[model samples]
Target: MMKIHEIRELIKLIDQSTINEFEYEENGAIVKMKKGVDAQVVSTFVPAPVAKQEIIAQPTVTSVATIEKIVEEPKAAEEVAKVEDANLHKITSPMVGTFYSSPSPDAANYVSVGDKVNDSSIVCIVEAMKLFNEIEAEVQGEIVEVLVKDGQLVEFGQPLFLVKA
Candidate 1:
């Protein structure tokens, strides 16, 4: 479980980064943070089974100046591409883990950019707590982009690939 100060620090880091959402989970505890319109910050917490409590924090304005600064920075080319591609389907991580593009070091990648994938196609593997979870494409499409590099730590709901359906 994360302490309140740790969560606040995470929120601050996220506010300063380009990421729009962040999630952390451990031992049945979960914390999620999302940036909303007007620079609002929303947080949700699910405690462990022993606690069995759900806590939702009210939207808070930590630093309006920082938020304004973030808004003023120009979007990069990749960011623009993501925004303009309306037909792209994002394949997101279902759990927090280390992402692997291949089954093993010597094995070929499951999928790559421009590869066609069906609903059951294995796209990647996410290893959490020593368990490798195979992630499927769920949507039939051509993969247009690979969002994360191999062995990167990914959070839940983090975009992993962009597919053109």
Candidate 2:
């Protein structure tokens, strides 16, 4: 079982970091925190006797304000991207990780708007657990949009690029 002080420390770290969600589990205990419009910190414990659960909604005043601001920025950006490329082929992330447009910080991006790509072409890289995996364009087309910013965390099936197939 994690102490309240430890949990408070975890929350502080999350608020200071770029991580939007965090999960920790140990000895039948699970702690999960997610930042958003209605940010929440949930902790669950399962005992051997039967099935027991508890959910605590403790959002700090400062955290709530910060979370709303963080959430709003992303929504605004996504809306613009969707409006501009409503009819394009979306290349989504295959796994959760940080999205990188170029191979290196100083290198050129693998694909840019108006660039032609085939099914085998490398479009970007998704870094997961210290490993950088090259993402391919499964559809042959000209790139019409880049949905995610470089170094942004992306989830599985999240749109990375829009291709005009």
Candidate 3:
């Protein structure tokens, strides 16, 4: 069974993270939890090495084990690409909204493919409830691809861009 303190620590991590839903099984103990709109969305990016280290070294401190994770194990060949993506950093949406690649329709895009972005770089904008939220790269690396197009409606925690870190 999962310990009460471990469960509490998981809740604390979720409350301050973009992942509203989480599930994990550790030591044969299963746990699942979700959050409402009150979940805090952080705009900072973590590099692959440090992020992976955190996942292994600090299970009780990180948001969830689902960071860029596939819920199921697949046997298809397409999964090879997914395996390759394991080293990439994914900048995800904080809320359900429209994904905009630029500040305005007439302006140039915030960051395109092959563009190098820093921790504070604004990669795109998510328009939710008439408010435009600037989504930051948070990870310093080259933008591998823009997963969503302008005016595209995206869900909360949806992957927006893949960065090669």
Candidate 4:
């Protein structure tokens, strides 16, 4: 459970910034605050979507952009490299297999670090039962890291690349 003081502190933090969003954890509780209509703040627990409630004061359009900028931090370029460094996205082998970065043993890899890709980008190849399978990117982003080395075995959902969208 979260403490009321922590929630109040979060409100203060949100008010202090140009970014209209802030999230923090205290005492095993995760607290998130988002700017709401009319200078009011909405609070919610983690793993649940935030629900809106009427606020006494309506927020100005300028504040809305500030909030957007804050919420958009996930897409910040600096974090992109962290995602790659952390190997966050796990591209798994759909079938039991050996993973290859290229169509053939002698070819270059399908995708490499810093490659801009869309949801349909073929980032790598997986070999199962002597057949080469094209593994496509499920999300849009730049390739951050390659978790598995070429010619390595991979399991289902095993991380292949970290992408930043």
| Tens digits of per-residue lDDT for model 4, 1-165 | 766796687677778887766666768777777776476654432333548463343435557786677556645855886555675555556765888888877888899999888888898888887788898898887887788898888766566777776
Tens digits of per-residue lDDT, candidate 1, 1-165, equal 788898889989999998887878999998888777577665433423545354344335768776655555534544786576877998999888999999999999999999999999999999998999999999998999999999999888888999998
Predicted model with the maximum lDDT = 2
Error at 21, model 2, angstroms:
21
Could you tell me the C-alpha RMSD of candidate 2 in Å? 20.2
Question: Which residue pairs collide, candidate 4?
Answer: 38-57, 38-58, 38-59, 90-159, 92-157, 92-158
Candidate 2 or 3, higher TM-score? Answer: 3
> What TM-score against the true fold does each predicted structure earn?
0.53, 0.50, 0.54, 0.46
Looking at candidate 1, the ten consecutive residues that score lowest on lDDT are 43-52
| lDDT score, candidate 2, position 11 | 98
Residue 11, model 2: Cα distance from true site in angstroms: 28
Candidate order by decreasing lDDT? 2, 1, 3, 4
Superior candidate under TM-score, 1 versus 4: 1
lDDT of 2 by residue, 70-121 (tens): 6577668878977767768889998889999999999999999999999999
User: For each candidate, what is the lDDT?
Assistant: 0.86, 0.87, 0.83, 0.73
Candidate closest to the true structure, highest TM-score: 3
RMSD of each predicted structure: 20.2, 20.2, 21.3, 23.5
